[model samples]
Target: MKPGEFAGKTAVITGAGRGIGEALAKTLCREGMHVVAGDIKKESVERWKESFPEQEILAVSCDVTKAEDCEALVQTALDRFGQLDYVISNAGILHSGAVDEIDPAVWKQVIEVNLYGTFHMIRAAAPVMKAQRHGVIVSMNSKSGKKGSYKSSAYAASKFGALGLVQSAALELAEYQVRVNAICPGNLMDSPLWTEGENALGIQYARNRGITTEECRAMYDRQVPLGRTCRYEDISNVLLFLLSDDSGYITGQALNVTGGFEMR
Candidate 1:
């Protein structure tokens, strides 16, 4: 994006405490946009605020699964910045298990956060954007949304729902000049989403497959034609385009940043 292309703009981003969400907050702030960063972890959101002492950043404790919290987040953006130009529904959770072995509650939690959360945010932001007659909404989907994964049924199901939500929202909001899109990223090895705990993808996959995490990582890396996993910056860059006027004509599309992992 041009240096000040987003100056004076404001955005509300979910899951801004870590991973791609954190990267998006920092990038947008540096590019001259005010950001309302929301995360379920209050402490993490506080830390994010501390890091941006000089920028216009509002850290909110938000549970996106709750519609009220989603509304509060959008209200805070308008209260602080007076206008909302973008909504980045980056909040999501991952779960991996065989359909029969997975706890029903686990499946529900994944859907609540990954799919319903997107719905709540968009539902709240849509009216505001529609009234203003201009805005952009981008959700963080996954390559699995386009195809099946070995043990990612729940996560993929939620993402597939989210992509559908994006398409439907795009069609409804386009007449008001609001564009909606989803970004499907492949495995991001360095992200907190995969490296956070024993349950994380790398460690979990390693244990399930009887290999070291390093070996698991190497195996997955070999699957990508680019021979590398995605980076937070890579997804954030696509977000920058979708939010900018450069991609004004694009809407209702699920764009892939998967390094040729899933060509569809």
Candidate 2:
């Protein structure tokens, strides 16, 4: 779609504190849309508010894991813009470990944050969109959702559940002019979600396989036929398309932005 088509539109993006969520929010704001940027951390929301003081952006703290917080997120958008045009269920967390050794608490935490978080966001937005009879919902899934990983039982399962939500919600919301879809990306660099613990996990894997950290990273790229890793912009391009009227015909589909890492 041409730029500024979203000028008067309003968007609600969960997990907008950092990484892909932050990038998506900035892009939409640049496109002239009023944005309700929600994150669990009040500081992160405040940081965004300060960074883009010129734009019509509302920053709020929202924990997607809580149903009430999800309700407040939708309310914030309506209170600010008087309507909602798009919703991005982008809040997520990752926990990687072998199935046998993974702690139950860790597994439950991943599901709660990633899977249930998506559900809560959608549940809160559906009624608002249905009442208006027009809306778009884009979910941030992962390539791991498409296939199992060596040591990512919880992470993979959570993402898989997210895709399920995307597909099911798409079918149910279609008649209401509410489009729902998902984007599955592979290993993004410099994302806030990739904590030092994740790095250590990679390093440990590298050591076990007798390869350097660089090699380990490269090994991941090699899995993708595209012969390269994806950057933040790569994912953003897809999200922009999905949110725009250009993708109005698209729904109930999960687009892969994984550089051919996982093909259907």
Candidate 3:
């Protein structure tokens, strides 16, 4: 599609500091949409502002886990652009722990950030979208959400919660012409949720499989039929469609952007 399909549209994307979120923001901006990008990291927010100074993009500091922050994010979008056309709840975190070994604290953190975070964004954005009588919402999910994983108790649970939220919101928002859907990506190479923090999980995965850390990483990639990890654009392309008129009839569905990894 040519750029500017969203020329007069305004959008808000949470957890847009880096990776897939960043990719989505850039794609929307390139498409001529006014974008408000939110992230928990101050540095990342500032960096985005500097990187795309020419685009109609605003970078805001926000913690998706907090209701107040979510409200503020919506307000910022409306205040700056006058209306919200698209809302993407892309903020999330991952915690790798076996069902028996996972700590409650870690489990709660995942739920708070992934599940509750998506709820807060949707709850706040829906009213504005309904009032306007036209809007699109896309939530970031995972292949794990559709299937089980070896050490993804918290992550999977959070994503499953997202599916429920999408369905409920779709039913309620239909009359207002606000469509809600989800994008489930698999094995992205550079998502902080997967590659950052908690080195212990990788070590544990290797130990469980009786292999090296390198082998564990390799094993994960080998499972993908594409024979390589996905880049953020691989997921962004699907998201762009879901947000555009191309997906006008799609709602309450979690489209898989996995590299043939999770066949339904």
lDDT of each: 0.92, 0.86, 0.86
Instruction: Name the best candidate (by TM-score).
Output: 1
TM-score of model 2 (CA atoms): 0.93
Query: Which one wins by TM-score: 1 or 3?
Result: 1
The residue pairs in collision within model 3 are none
Residue by residue across 1-264, what tens digits does model 2's lDDT show?
A: 875688889999999988788888888888888999889985786776677778878888898889999999999889888999999998888767789999999999999989999999999999999999999999999888899877889989999889999999988999999999999998874455542554555566678799987887878778778887778889888998998889989999989998877886
lDDT per residue (tens digit) for residues 166-234 in model 3: 999999998998999998988775455456655655566677789986887888889898887778788
Writing each residue's lDDT as its tens digit, candidate 1 over 52-121 gives 6778688899999999999999999988889999999999998878998999999999999999999999
Off by over 4 Å in 2: 195-210
Model 3 residue 208 lDDT? Answer: 77
Task: Compute each candidate's TM-score over C-alphas.
Answer: 0.98, 0.93, 0.92
- lDDT (C-alpha) at residue 218 in model 2: 78
**lDDT over C-alpha atoms for residue 154 of model 2:** 94
Candidate 2 Cα lDDT to native: 0.86
